[model samples]
Target chain A: MSVLVYTENWDGVFKKLSFELVSYAAKVAEMMETSVTAVSIGDVADDELAKLGNYGAAKVVKVDGNTTLDNQVYTGIIAQLAEAEGAKVVVISHNNTGKALAPRLSVKLKAAVGAGLIALPSSTEPFTVSKKVFSGKAFANVVLKTDVKILTLAQNSFEVIEVGGTATVEASTATAGEAKTTVKDVQKQTGKILLNDAEIVVSGGRGLKSGDNWGIIEELAEVLGAATACSRPVSDEGWRPHEEHTGQTGKIIAPNLYFAAGISGAIQHMAGISSSKCIVAINNDADAPVFESSDYGIVGDALKVLPALTEAIKEAKNK
Target chain B: MKIVVCLGNVPDTTTKVKFGDGTAFDKTGVQWIINPWDELALTRAMELKEDAGNPVSSVTVVTVGGKDAEPTMRKALAIGADDAIRVDTDARDAYAVAGQLAEAIKDKGFDIILTGIESSDYNGSMVGGMLAEMLDVPSVSAVSGLTISGSDVEITRDIDGGKEQVSVATPLVATVQKGIAKEARIAAMRGIMMARKKPLAVVPAAEVETLTDFVSFELPAPKPPCKMVDADNVAELVDLLQNEAKVL
Candidate 1:
């Protein structure tokens, strides 16, 4: 039996999350005393596929030519690969691809799935895993009673250990089912830190007053190399695009450091960001709910306090 | 065009979360609502149906849960669904839930199926994709915008950092997030009265064995009381963040 990881490839290379998945799969494989294999689909380069070995994958199966990241088709292929390899555990990153594929794969393989998993298996006896639930407000211990276990690791939840090595890439071809939906065009936000892969995030809220004031928020985020997010109200108000919204009904992020400026901590907003390792809230209202969930609360106006904090951090880093 | 909007009944976000026997959720005193995300999907479908010169015919809401889920289903109908289907079963894992839903929707003449990206209760965004696989249809997730013209469906879905436009034929499934509709509609008196007269069918759940078991539930560790820094003491806050929080 093997531990199989679905390593997501972006363009021609594997991103940070892909390596993290392999690193995690390696750990699980060690615990089971088995090897780990990675499955990559679409048009990724060979050297990129080989780099997965640095993280722990022993073998890489590259399905050439498929470009679109269609979850419906990938699910069928992964299910087939898992069966052929006698994979006992399937590891996938809890990103868009995994979110779309894991449950469907579980149904195809008759495997018990733990989605948005936060940590390693607590016990392998009953195959227990811990995952974020209730939009990160709580945790649940889920047991996969079935023989085959499928799990998706929460993004930024695990550390990546790099051990220098290279994996053997094997070319494989399988029928990717016809896509009923066609991607007419792909528009990616370029030249900035991607939110899902960001380690630190600086977010704003309606308290910023208007879209023009977002320049200050952008400056702070740029200094920190952090991705920018906004409260739901700000997004709804069109001060920021809807994609920047982070909350219970929005993107649930778990960066190591989350900075919220001018945002009152609404319960729904907190639900999406409470998983961050350290949270800092800056708001004018001393009674704002964001403070209750933050590690440090600055009872000040974000407009004044954020500029000062950003300049200070820039100085500290330069020193 | 017939569209099926999948429904999930979730505890109101403000409900103090507590686990029963540490195994499952305690249902008492929990006010259930049509999951905010699903409400968005339903409202969007209704708007498209009532759109000027649109070809949409009906919107049907589907859910897999016990009788406790009825009120939430009723709310969907009032919001504008023409009919409803309840696959009567205890809430199970995503796979079983999707299986029951797929079984219920298989023979239905629905050309489009919609679901919230994930349920707020479990936060599993897998059902819609799984349903697509079961029904052998195309699936899209995190759709922020949608438009339907005859058999042509166009959707705008959020990707890693931006959004993409996808066009697909009929017999497609989509798990939608917000931005599809400005707001979920509240059932008016007439809509509420009409909902009571609409068709609400209860069917036995398909026999699919659940895969995952909930061992226990626990709240996350609480944050320490906030360390307040005076509005002007930005320097001190930075020092605390660097030395104490170690996040700088």
Candidate 2:
């Protein structure tokens, strides 16, 4: 049996997410004393296919198609591949696509699943997977008991390693049933990184005073090459787009760094960003709950703190 | 058109989370409420039913929980759901829960099923997808906007770097998130009074094999107090981030 990893490639290029999944799959495969097989549904170039090997994939299968990510079809194809390869463990990312397809695949394969998995199984014997729950405030160690197990790794939780190797690449195709959902339109955001994909995020809140006063926050984010986010109140007040909001009622993100300016950390807001690797808060109130959660705190007007911090970051980058 | 909005009973969002048993969630002194996202989904379903065309014939709410989950179901009925169904059981796992739901609702002939993207407690966002698979239907994930036009069900979902507007027929599932409705609907006094009269069917849960189980839980460690950085020496903050945190 093999460990199968669903490596998502966009426009024939694999991103950090794919490598992470492959890396995770390789480790899980090692635990099970099996080989790793990577699967890509859409068009991925030969050179790009080899990259999966660097992360320990022994074999990579490129399913040639002009893929339009239909969850059912994808599930069918993956399930078929798993059966053909005699896969005992399957790895997928706990993102939008995986969110929709993993369960279907689990049901189809009659395999147990642990979604939002943060770490490798604490015990491979029982196949216990550690995952974040309660909005990252707590951790749950879930055990998958079935012979076949499915795991959707949480984003940014696992590091991508170049474990020096190469994978055998092959081309194949399979027929899945018709697609019921039609993608009518897709509007891509430009000029900024998406919050979900960002490594560093700079956010503002009600303390920013007004929508027009967001120049400092933007300037800092631009200097850091990071995405800009806002609190729920900022979005509700129309200071920022609803898409930029980060809180319990808004987007939940886990970036490498979360920089908050002029925001009092509400419990709801904290729930969204508590998973960030490092957090720095800039607020005039020293006692703001944000300070309690942040690694670094600057008690001052965000309007001034932001610009100075931005200039400093720019200077540091140059040096 | 008929709709079934799956409701998950969770502790109030404001409630401080505590673990009673090692792996089981603590429920003592906690107020149970309909999950926020499910409430919003129900509100949107209510709006669709009350639309001018009245294209929607009925709205039903379903849950996989024990007797403690009934109050939350009643709240959904008060929020305008036509009826409620409780699969009397604990939500042991997403796969088992979905199996129970599919067994209970397969012959019910509901055209559309809506579920929150995830629950606030466990946040296991797998049930909706499993529902679609179990019933052999399509599902839209990360759904931000859901609307009905004639017979078409329009669903807008949040993708990685963009938004995709998709359309699908009924017998589909849409896992809902924020922006499905402007605000959660508040039940009026009359709605509450009538909700008491609404029918709540309690069905026995299917004896499905549990695939996953929680072995243990651990609360996150307390973060150290923030290192104070003077606003005047903002450059020092950068130095600390670089040398100390190594995040720069």
Candidate 3:
């Protein structure tokens, strides 16, 4: 009859998505008339787990283990916790870690699970959950009739709320499963925004003509403190790294503000970014498909439009 | 090495989305196809098999969908999968799908399991990770490059801002991301002709766990009309972004 929320961390620090999930779980806990306990696994520090209390978690459960990104080990631990706590509902963030853990925990607990959830459960007979479908092209409502329910909320789907309070931290020990995998090294990208977590994104397309002329795009991104992205053709042409590509065939992203400069929006590209809150397009072709999806459309040469936009951003920030 | 690529039949990315009276999707008139991410996973699996000089004995494609998904399942066969398995069910929930897949493959003795990072339709991106957990194996997600040497697999994943490289033992699961490999080759006329002869198996979905349920579906609010700012009005555009949108 209790609710358990998985508090996600990265390199020992809590991620923003953790707070967002906790905020979301708090609401569900309130509606269900149950207390919410936030759980963190694998070497999380005491002070860090304590921060969960501010987000409405009544208590924080910290399980210490030398953990890698192994789903089996994490799931085993979560299953034990859920069973021990007699949790009726488990809330997790639909990020990399949650995506890996939620389904396994559901299987182990014999609980129903829903992923890509966008909002709190509707207060209806079946208690349906809303989720994004078709790469943000559509929506689907899922109802969980089981006594135990597992829900993985989409990242950035719910607004982060702050309810100032202190969380009680409790240390719990669990059996550690031997990892079948070995991690020899961890190489991380330097000086790049995590594309998924970026608030502002500046993307380019084939209209930039070549890789050498990417300075304008980078400058604009820099001025706006935004992440950089590109269209499929731009990546295929080797004008940008494949990781920078954002489209249906590439990475799908939904940022607060997306500036698509020099790219024609193909259906595939639109499919990936159509969920972005605000879209601005800068292209010479007035009929470009990107214009159709953009909140604001500027019909002009990108080479000219980009520099102007960058300068404008810099000036506005300074003022 | 034996690799299993889990596939899901999903609505085409371009299909118009409509929700029924409840939260479940209205499937009428929606064209179904193999999820695009899963296609990337299958293509990568096939590539790894080829690069290993056919060290891979079998490439199995697994799906949890209804009989209507057989054509899409057959397409995997055309793309070089040796065999296919369709768990007879239309369970769209990730947990149920993972349970069915884990049950079918748990005893299959697979060394590697590959799946798309997320399905284009559900965008759940949960099964691969869950399956690995249920099978008690290590799992990496959003892997862009994978190389196998003996029992160890080296994977490179795109993390926030940068990439992470991990080396794990065999019997591992990986969710493949785009840009990990070249575009998947479409079935050639000859390949298509031969796919009809490939072995396709159907099995009832496992009854393991039930968690969430769909209540109804709702379309996102229609987008507002585009407001064009004259190219000369750059300042006004900036003002709107800063004041109106409050996103600047």
Candidate 4:
């Protein structure tokens, strides 16, 4: 038996998220007294595939020739690999692609699935794992009883371990299934870091007054090298794209650092970001609910405070 | 074409979650509403049915909850579902929930099935995909945009770095998120009165093996009060971030 992990790559290269999954799988394999077999489907380069070994992948199953992710086709491939390898536990990341594929895999393999898992399993016998539930407002320990276990690691939850090793690479014997969907078009977001992958984020809210004044939020984000986000109303008011909205009804993010400028700490907004490690708030109202959750607060008009904060960060970074 | 949009009657977004029987969600005095994501899906279903160009015939909303959930189901009809189905049991996990739904929806020949990406409660994010696998049909996930065209549906799903558009045949499951609709449509007074006459079927939950039992629930630790800083001392905030928070 082996621990099989599905690692995702972008443009023939792997990112921190993939490495983190392999790292998590490696530990699970060790706990189960087995080895880790990592699978890469699509256009990941040879050298890039070798990096999985650094995180304790004992073998790499490379499936070539797919440029884009077709969820059903990929699901068929991963499900077949797990059955052939006798995967005791199948590991994957809890990102968008994983969300689309993991549950399908669980059904095909008859495995119990734990999505958005935050840490290593507390026990391997019952296969108890912890995952984020209730939009990060709380956590629950789940017991997976099926013989084959499947887990999707919550992004950035586990540390990437670099253990010296080399993995045997093999070409996948599984072929693609019949495609049921046709790709119509693609619109890739350019420039800034994607919110789900960002480590730090700077956000604004309705308190910012106008969309044109968003230059201050951007300036601060530039100084901090953070992604820009906003509350639902800010996006609703057309001050920012809906993509930037972070709330219960919007995107739920858990970056290491989150800066909320002029955003009130509403329960909806807080549900999306309460998992953030450090939250800093800047607003004119000293009694705003945001202060109750923020690690630090500056009671001032965001329009004025944002520019000043940006300049201070620039000066501090230069020093 | 008939559409079945699944609804999750969960605690309101702003409700403070408190545990009741150690791990069970405390519902006392907590106002429940259709899950935000599911509400959006219902809104889109209504829009599709209302549009003159679309082939949508009827829209049905289904939920896996007990009798108390009927009020929430009535609200779904008020929001514009043609009918509602209640599974008549509080499911143990997503796996069982999907099985119960499959039992209720199978052989019904619904052309399209809609589910939210994740419920605000539990946030399991699995029912739609598992239901599709059980029914042996194709499915799309994290769908931001969906439109029916010539007996086929074009879907826009979120991928890393950007968006991807794909088209799938009917009798498929599609899990959607925000951007599918501008905002959830509230019930008008007329719609509310009409909902009173709508049919709500409460069927028994199917017996399915439950997976992943929850051992316990723990609320996150609340952060200490924010340290107030002077606007003039912006540099101090930067210093604290770098030295104290160590997140720089």
Candidate 5:
């Protein structure tokens, strides 16, 4: 039996999450007493797939194609490869694309699957996996009893291990099913970090008061190299775009550090980012719910707290 | 035109999660609600139906959950769906849930199928994609805006680096994202009163093809104690990040 890691690529370059998954998969493989094989589908270059070796992949399976992530077709291919290689464990990143493919693959392989996994599997019996639950408010460990196991690791959950090694590349011949969806065009966001992948997020709420005053928030985000997010109320008020809103009723994110300035932590807002490793809340109200959920709380006006925090971060980065 | 919105009865986002002996979440004290994203989907469907000048014949909400989810299902009807269906089963995995929805609507002939990008509970975000594949229809994920023109639906989505716009024919599936529609409307008092009278059909789930199983559930390790550094000590904070936490 072998462990299979799904290596995701964008524009011919492997995503950082793919390396993270490989590193985690490598650990799982060691526990399973099997080597890890990294598989890349779509139009990824040979060198791109070869790079998986550095991330602990023993073998690289490159399936040459121009497939645009047709879920059924890709699931069938992965299933065929898993069966042929006798893979006992499969790992994928918990990204948009991975989210689209992993569940179907779980069904195809009849494996117990864990999504939103945030840590490595437990060494204890039954092989439990921990995953973010309730929109990141809490985490739950999932144990798999199935012989074949599937795991979708949350992005940035594990540190990437760089044990550069050579990976044996092999060409796999697999037939892809007809794609039901066609890609007409892809519109790309300009000059901003994708909220889902951002490491540090600086979010605002209705306290910002108006959309015109957003320059302060954007400036802080720019200085910190972080993404900008807003509360549901901010979005509802049209002070910020909906895509920038993060809450229980919106997008759930798990950044390394989340800075909530000029925002009270409503249960809804906390639900989206409670999974953040560290949260710093700067609000005038000491009784804000956000402070209760935050790792650090500063009872002060955001207009003052934000500029000071920005300066501090800038000075720290410069040092 | 007929639209199908797949809804999941999910725990409130703030609910504390307790892990079972195996890797399944404990449902104790968890208040169930319509998955937030699904609410967006339902709202968008209603918008489309209204925009079509009532050309749409029906908007059906479907879920795979026990009878306790009926109230949440009725909430969907109150919000504007024509009817609701609860496929009697506990939603264990994304694939099984998607399969149940797909089978229920296979021959029902829906022009468009909508679901949230991901449920707040499991965060699988794969059900819509899998359901689209199962139904053999074009699919789009995380659509922030949609406009139906003639036989095609123009969808705008937020991608990794940017936004994307695509056009697909009828009988397609799309996952609703934030900003896709206006703020979801609360059930009006009249609608809430009328919801009790709406048709909420309960049916046993068709034999589903199970792909994944939950062996058990456990709580995550407690976070380490937080160490506070003086606000003026920027250098110290940097040192802590680079050396102690090693996050940098």
Candidate 6:
């Protein structure tokens, strides 16, 4: 019997989220009185797989080749492996890949699943876990009645732990089935920080007035080394790309620092960013909902306040 | 091409969220709207159908909800779905919802299925993927762009740092976000009048076992009111950010 952790690997290496998964699964395995096994698919080096032991995996299983991950194929493989290993608990990251697979695995395994989980199980008896609901406005304590359980940990929700150790790597014979979709092209935003992985984010909204005035938001973001984002209205107005929009209908972010300049925090907008650690709002309206949710607020026009704040931060960094 | 656009009725974005006793949510007086994301998907599908010499044959909107949800289904038809289906039951979880949808879709012979990436209410973001897996079809998650040509559909999906373009054969599923359609269209009076004659089937919910049970719901703690600072004193705001908020 073992606790299984799906350690996602990309570009021949394990992602940072994979390390965090092993660290989390290790603790859960200890409580469950079982060893932790890390599962990897696609092109990953053996040495890299072995290094996961540092974060506390007892063993690593690699499903090799340049196979592109399709949700259907990966879910089948993981579910079959879990049953074969008698894994009582399965852990997955609550990111794009995980979100796409976890629910399918739960249904296939007939196991209860808790997704976007913010913390460890409150108790294993009834197998209760907490996950964000109503966007980020609320949390629900969900109890799983099934014998097996699946969990997808929310990004940045848990601390990563590493204890010195080593892991045994085993090459699996599991091959993916035929895929229905084929990749045509991949267009990467090569130079800019990705929103999901960014630690700091600077965003603007309709208050910027025009696409031409977006230079100030970009200048502030550049100074802070933060990814740029925009409100739904800004994206709708075509002032910014749709991928850069963060809100109820857009990307959900949890950056350490979030700057909302010229953005009036609509409830929809707040839903996507409420998880951010520290939100700073610069808006002309004192009554903007962004101020109500932000940790700090400056009552002024974003055009004037943003440049001043950017200069101040630049000065502070110099000092 | 026949398209199945999955819809979910949710409380309006502006609705104040309150938890009821036990496992229930306080839905009293909450005005429901067609989920904004699903509405966007429906609008985009309508645009494709309305274009000159378009290839689309029909647009069907499906949902897992009770009679109270029929109005929302009607709204979907008014917004331009050819027909609507409401599975009569309360949706327990994403898995159960997807199971019901898959059951309804298995015999429909839909060439393409579209759903919002995540519903505004629960934000589970898993149903579309689950449906795809159940039906044994190709699916793209959170697609921002989609173009259909013959039996091949090209989709643009946003990853953490980049965008990927993938092509899938017919009988494809796509969980779409905002960029699939720049704007959602309002129902014209003629569309609304026509929607009255549209077929809306209320099928009994399939007996699928639910995976998770909710014990309770809790609202997030109220944040302290914002501390208004003079706009000119950027230094003070900076100090607060560094010393207090520690974001710096």
Q: What TM-score results for chain B in every one of the models?
A: 0.97, 0.95, 0.95, 0.97, 0.93, 0.97
**CA displacement after TM-score superposition, residue A113 of candidate 5 (Å):** 1.7
Off by over 4 Å in 5: A123-127, A316-319, B14-31, B53-55, B133-138, B209-248
lDDT at residue B246 of model 3 (Cα atoms):
83
What would the TM-scores of all predictions be?
0.97, 0.97, 0.92, 0.98, 0.89, 0.96
Q: Which parts of model 3 have CA positions greater than 4 angstroms off?
A: B18-31, B52-54, B204-210
Write the residue-wise lDDT of candidate 3 on B9-62 in tens digits: 888877877766655577899888888878888888888888855467888999
Residues A103-165 of candidate 1 have per-residue lDDT tens digits of 778878888888888788998888999887777767899889899999899888888989786
Superposed model 1: Cα runs more than 4 Å off: none
Candidate 6, residues A1-319, lDDT tens digits: the string is: 8999998876777766788789889988988889999888887889999999999999998888636667777887888788878999999988878877887787778777788876888888888988888888888888988899988887766767988889999988775577666888888788888887778999999888999999999999899899999999899888899889998888888888999998999988999899899898998988888888998888898999999999999999999
Comparison by DockQ, 2 against 6, better one: 2
Query: Model 3's CAPRI class?
Result: medium
Please give the DockQ score of every candidate, comma-separated: 0.76, 0.80, 0.63, 0.80, 0.44, 0.77
Q: Candidate 2: lDDT over CA atoms?
A: 0.89
Q: How far off is residue B125 in model 3, in Å?
A: 1.8
lDDT of 5 by residue, A1-319 (tens): 8999888777778777788999999989988888999888888877888889998999998888845666567777888888888998899877766766776676567676778787778752676776666666556555676788888887777888999888999999887667655567886677778898889898998777778878888888998789999999899898887878898767778889888887888877887787788787777776777777776666667776677766776887787
Task: Please write out the lDDT profile of model 4 over residues B82-194, one tens digit for every residue.
Answer: 99999999868888888899999998989999999998888878888889888888889889899999889999998888888899998899999988898899999999999
Residue B129 lDDT in model 6?
82
How accurate locally is residue A117 in candidate 1, as Cα lDDT from 0 to 100? 82
Model 1 Cα displacement at A175 (Å)?
2.1
- lDDT for predicted candidate 4 compared with the true structure: 0.89
The segments of candidate 2 whose C-alpha lies over 4 angstroms from its true place after superposition are: none
The DockQ value obtained for model 5 is 0.44
lDDT: worst 10-residue window of model 6 chain A = A64-73
- The CA lDDT of each predicted structure is 0.87, 0.89, 0.81, 0.89, 0.79, 0.86
